[model samples]
Target: MAKKPYSNEADYVIVGAGSAGCALAGRLAEAGKQVILIEAGGPDTSIMFKRPGMITMIHSEPKLKKKFDWGYYLSPQEHVNNRRLVATRGKVMGGSGSVNGMIYVRGNKENFDSWEAEGNKGWGYADVLKSYKRMEDWQGPDSELRGKGGPIKVLENPDICDAAKTFIEAGASALGVPVNPDYNGASQDGMHVIQENTSNAIRFSSSRGYLTEQELPTLEVQQRGTVSRVVIEGSRATGVEVIEEGGQRRIVKARTEVILAAGAFGSPQILMLSGIGPAEHLRGHGIDVVADLPVGDNLHDHLFMPMTFAMDNSPHHSSAFYFGKALLKDRFKPGSNFLAHSVFEAGAFLHTSLSQSTAPDMQLFAIPWSYPPFQDDPVRLSPDKRPSLSAFSTLIRPKSRGTVRLASADPLAAPIIDPKLLSEPDDLKVLLEGVEMIRAIMADSAIAKHVKEEYEPGPGYTGDKLRAEVIKRVSTVYHPVGSVRMGVDERAVVDPELKVRGIDGLRVADASIMPTIIGGNTNAPSMMIGDMAGAIVLGTGL
Candidate 1:
């Protein structure tokens, strides 16, 4: 544990340099305000993070993931055959956005409107549109809804394999789901190729896009800086106590406010550590309460159950040797490199027959490569064998809620993350229907031409058998939010303006503040919150 002199203050002190923190810090600094961004992880040095092909290797390869990943495993899930799933959260500068699959999803317009309807004013689709438009530099074919000339490069991968083409077409002809070229556009009902946070086959993360250009004298970013707790004076949050590399402690003050942008799990854990959670829970940890609130409650996330099918000859190949040769020469056109995009290039959304919800409750996406079965329930995956297309039946709007509680009083100890997945019966029902829909899509004549075999939940699987397979196979899609929820209710962590309910000069600006989890990828929404929250805190518009 070496030591270095740390800055004592800034106008705004933002903890966790994740999606929200980057957008907030960048916007505040750009507004001519002094800002300090702190992150627990080290620098973004891995070349794997720069290349899309190698990013998922972080999920598979242990050595590559060790540097930035928190590696937190959850408690055993009772609904999912009592299996404990590993939690994958990035501890890097850009937070999860640094290591996450860079699929850019703005979520549905109704998703934000639902937030406002839940007593959070000004978070409606129309109101929050400016923040997203302000942050995205859309490179794809755009209309008035899309934004241009923003910092984060939002580009659709121009290159698509013949297999992906068939997947999109089958969604329209077979499943009755329309072929929407852009899901982020007017309607989110149909299947379309996903846009990614990339430019010229290079990853565009919050750390790279937002913080990289903020070399201004006012903005200071500290890496390997773990925030122990928010220093509260009476009922107001004044600053944060940070532990730098090698056991050094520093108090970084915030003149305006202390913003907590540490994601869903981390934010609640920090709040509980700071003695700002449920009263009885705080006393049990032997810490004096600051502002007792439901900091770690209302935790929910998206879960996906993958079904793979052996396909006929596909027009795609995973040749790492040839890719390496091309990478060495640095030859790739912007948005034209297949290696830069995740294999989950195409996706579809639908409202299940069982559910009466207007918005699509189920999301479907395809991965070209055959991934190993989840926890070995006999999905018959061949990762290196013949070509297989895997489609994930995902539950975006989940009814099951969970919690993030402190395992101990120690700031360094990882918190107990129990998503309590599949705890609700409706969740299981929706997922079952989703699987049924995906099977129908595979059975369609247009898609059936490519299918060689049904891997899991095939002919014999019905009723109890299919239900058992779903519980065994369903796993998180890595989008966790709503731990530190925002609302006007008594249990709400923050208000509409994102102010901590029981504390002054404190706010939370991240995915944690979402009242309900959005119906799609959360990375884009998280950054949008950062941008909008920064403006609200500064009392200005972008």
Candidate 2:
């Protein structure tokens, strides 16, 4: 059969049904608007996407993630021995939120305050807190800070392995901080259970929370609708050109506005494809220049280096066995099914003497299990059972920046992603301190008896050797941002209101627009940006 023509029009044409697109489309539909949410990837109903424990399978097998993962590769990082790393962005409906390790971190309060201090008026913590509340359906304990009764239910991952008990216990004892139950509550400065995007063991992704919860006649979705470019007329973005699943190319017009929620890498790639990037580069690609604002420049992402310790313990069970138990033994229970939620091992944040900032420069991730990332990946340690409890000190505020450039004019071709990790000399120093801090956290006496030995850099590694180990073992925590950064400055791609600079009837609301990477996970904050964008389009005070 010949391909059916795509819908040519909608009041709002939103690109990429990732976290931001789903949230924005839902909000627009709620207000009775015709919205088109186009996704390049497939749906999220498969068995692989549901079971959280299958993450091991989803990760170990590249083919399993290919359907939902963009799976982009980075250019040789000069900092990490010129090694290329895989940057995983979700290609499916729920986007990365559906595939990620459901760690719902709201970032440090100072991260947003820094955004406001950088000339973004409405982006301060006080300004976006209400918007954050509007998007969250938090079911956790009573707290004045966390939102209540909204979409996207938040809960602590109940499937935490027995090793997490040691992680939290040791973290609280060593760091001199209490084992705070709610990290999203009063403050985000202590060791706590990993808050997740699931109510039970079931992953409640943004797509599940916003798009799949209810069907509205106002909202329409075109899965596998790969967008080629935003069709620009004069200075306005009037529509988008896309190649549908069955090799049919069509234009989806926007009557009022066109929004780009295609995430950090994708949003920039689409902009450059539409001739809204560096003029000289667009000419090189034989494309007419629409707006020559620095589109792909100023890219940055959070980096984490882990330190795993071999453990002699076991409380492991097959997910199939637990899923069966959940179906039979614990019927009709809300959070009883351990197989339903992501394996949220435990997490924390720490400070080093090198940083005088109020907010911690180094973030820590303590996991009960470990997968050896490198032979001497001191970051990733393991046991004979490979049941190792690990601590990862993620660099929250990174100074090094990179770029995203078009590899080819073809819409299907992947963009060149160069996240110049640890490019700055100070970045190395901060992370070096972070590694040492994790060693200290693990060295706490409260739970010191169960350890065997430090595998990498055990007795001799020092100074430059230690720094090299930290650099070589580093990998992206899967948080990329700032390619299409927002601000009021000359270099800003979008204004504080998320309006793309030098273009009308076009806006970008996603993690891409963040002026800087937030101190925590980007999923919740990206949804907040989408909610704010909806308010901006409707002329409501955000």
Candidate 3:
């Protein structure tokens, strides 16, 4: 598994060493094909990346912007508070998974089936189930729904707080939603324990899980290299132009194909920078248009509104305290009681509106303690401070589509990300229902005894009051997808095989290609796309 130098040519050139990039690189290399992976960020070497609860520490670190984070900000949306939301992307090898909450959600099966219905061939639930199974290594009991041996480790913890347990019971009872043992099992519409990407109390990022030391020889990962644009010849990508350490620009040709696994933002940006996006927009930036396909026109993301509560009893479930103490303990005694640092204990997926034909459109992440926004600071909540619970409701399958357009002609300039959340009135209706649902779950008698007061929106706030509050606080979960959507349509950026609609030797293998966002987290699905892309590149899928 010796590291190999980047040669002048490779069978495949994969951009961005993020979740999908890592998976694609490993899989392509495993097929005995030479692959070169370029990443803008440096290597993932932070101690916080290995610790389960150290996500807070990583978010707070000043070096986050320089090391593992792209630190992009979204344009102000007029629909919400007109407040600009901060979008953090991974700059490191593992990408956002290294900085994320590490939740291993596969989303609802029906979500994929819907893609098939929308003319995206070979992307139905059945087709993706195999990919999911291929990537997972479940630590819990084996079942038809769970995978036993795979790259990513998915596990559940039994040390969750009593508040979390009671919330599940009471919340389900109040809403008549059944309790499900596994969200990935029989059904996705119920309260259940969350499955996390943790292995023995350590965060298992895709870089560590898929590209282990044993697989390095097959994969040549190049870090600290900023990709400028895709090298295209006669509307077909053949290589990439990158800026090396000393600001030296070099072109590396690909013998077979060029794959863009650079996540949602990076993927679409790269395509547009290479003159392969909407002709009108590219022309506005003074760039020559190659294909004029709609590369960044169909952006979508999960918008979340945080519903909070104020409690009256001291609890040991605070995420901040757990992570801080875990870090200190790791410095003193490594591998001693690692379970104490796990962040998410339990979660649920539900249909905010029962009448909708769609599956669960909202997901609830139940945290037993309170922390600052993004959990980016030390535990400031005193031990004597009352414990609280929060239900972060995200609109999973949003119909409102936006775009990522070039802010300038410069390839190094960041793209303008306009998610346009809640542009459709129905989306707002679903969000309002989500807020009401959270209230209903909290009001359940099984856990009502611990409730003290409503912290957000207040008790008197109802109807339009609550709706207004929702619009005021709603923000993105950073799960933007579909900018370079894949489908069998004339306007689609990529075809069913993930090849750019009107181009050859180029494909997008990231969240950007998803015709729509899944019912839950995008990290797992992104990696699965990467795996599928690797197979497609090797001519296995064809």
Candidate 4:
């Protein structure tokens, strides 16, 4: 196979084709500028993309390697459960959003406000709110807070089971937590139905939303293309070197800019492969230095420990039930799940310590049933099961940070992902408090009626023993950020405008630019970043 060259130079060469890349490509191409969108994975027009909770089926499909997943795994974590967990990123056009849980959460206002406080001008809640509204087409009652006429569909899942609803109401009432209708509203301090990225029983990934109605005369989307290096010339990113399907390598030049949206892991890997990482790390790999900024330092992700309680009632909490209903061609056809079933999905933000910042240090996601363990084979629990309600505690504002270093200057080689989870003793203390809080919620009379026993770590486990067990079973909640932090400081990789520091014609737009992790799920915030990045790149908004 011969390598293909860019016959015509595009105004914008967007790499990765993930959430941010899709938005950027759509917007830039719509603006009448030539754009080339390259994706490591293939297109996301598969049947599996429509199933709501079919993450397992999607992951198991062998086509994922060729289509929409990078399928990267982390190096061992000394602090975590001593296992190298799988980190599945979409190799498809829509990126990870195509394969993620599809829960749409915008985090808290304080999270964005903190960016402004850190000298990142025009990134506060007030500025990003418009971008959020601009990107979403919400289903429920729209107000000043939610959007009604955007590409992405944000709707509440109506097919949530009766047990799930009872679980939320009972659990929140017992714990004195308010029943908040919208977490994305004025405050993010209550429980409510989870908002999802579904429209008519299909997954509405960035690719679908951004490119559906747009007509781009000069936009070309290439899938099954792997980026090997960012081509820099005289401190300017001019283009990229990539390997196509049959392993043919080519260098495609960009006339204007090369925007990297390869996500937290892929972006850093490309930067390092292009000799634009930490000085010593680059030299160690025998790669000549470019800008030598911290490309992969300050890595962070949301760490979660699942607290499971066996419910007394035999609640219908099975994936079989959900998917079976979807497969059956009864009166309950497509989209009926959203109209009928009511699964209670709610989040709570709390301060582990009174002296902490305004944002909630601990974030909780209450689910009606227990799914299989993270990265487990078969991707389903055994048929012998029980009714359970799980409260997952995520260390929202972690103090400890990690790094993503190259394995051997090889883009194909997996990056060294050391999140340094629980490196700070304070993190453990807060997590411990979260564990206690979940226990208290389950113990409450209203919630207790649904519970039969504690399954994980078992009953009669308390004090340091329980604490140790919590650490033993904890896993990542899939919210990785800050590997390429944004700021005006010397250590920062990108500036407030998301432009790479000390470099021109290059910018990073993804979760990688977050200076710190937000208080809740990162999907909505990441999309917000994509929206803001599009506006910034187009010079349309502040």
- In lDDT terms, which candidate is top? 1
List, residue by residue over 142-218, the lDDT tens digit for candidate 4.
68999888889888876655545665676477567787778778877766677887877777778888875567788
lDDT of 3 by residue, 1-542 (tens): 98655676788888988889888888888888888888888777667777776665555556655456776778877777666777778788898988788778888888899999989878888888888888889888888877788888888765677778887897689888898888887688898887888876677788888886345565677878888899999978899999887888889889888999888899889888899888988898888999888888889888877766765432544545555676677777765654334567777888866337658877888776653433211222222234677777778878788888889977677889888878888888887788787888778888777888877656787888878877877778879888888888866888878888778899888998888788898989988988887777777862
Q: Model 2: which residue pairs collide?
A: 137-150, 201-340, 201-341, 306-379
lDDT of 2 at 343: 58
The residue-by-residue lDDT of candidate 1 on 1-542, one tens digit each, is: 78665688998999999999998999889888998889898777566677665565566556656767887877888787878887888988888998887888898888999999988888999888888888889998768788998889988767756566677777777778788877788888988887889886677887778878556578888888889999999888899999877898889999878999999988998899999998898899998898889989999999988877777745443344544554555444533455577667778888886556667888888777665567432122235445777778889999999999999999889999888999989888888887877778777767778888877546577899989888878889889999999999986999999999879989999999999988899999999999998889878865
Off-target runs (Cα >4 Å) in candidate 1 are 1-4, 315-337, 375-384, 456-459
lDDT of 2 by residue, 303-400 (tens): 87766677655254324444355556334654454457665568887666666777777777766655455532221233334446667778888899
Error of 4 at 167 (Å): 2.8
State residue 512's C-alpha deviation in candidate 2, in Å: 0.5
Off by over 4 Å in 3: 1-5, 312-323, 335-342, 371-386
Q: Can you give the lDDT of residue 179 in candidate 3?
A: 88
3 or 4, greater by TM-score: 3
| Candidate 2, residue 48: lDDT | 59
Q: Pairing residues by index, what is the TM-score of model 1?
A: 0.94
**Per-model TM values vs. the true structure:** 0.94, 0.92, 0.93, 0.92
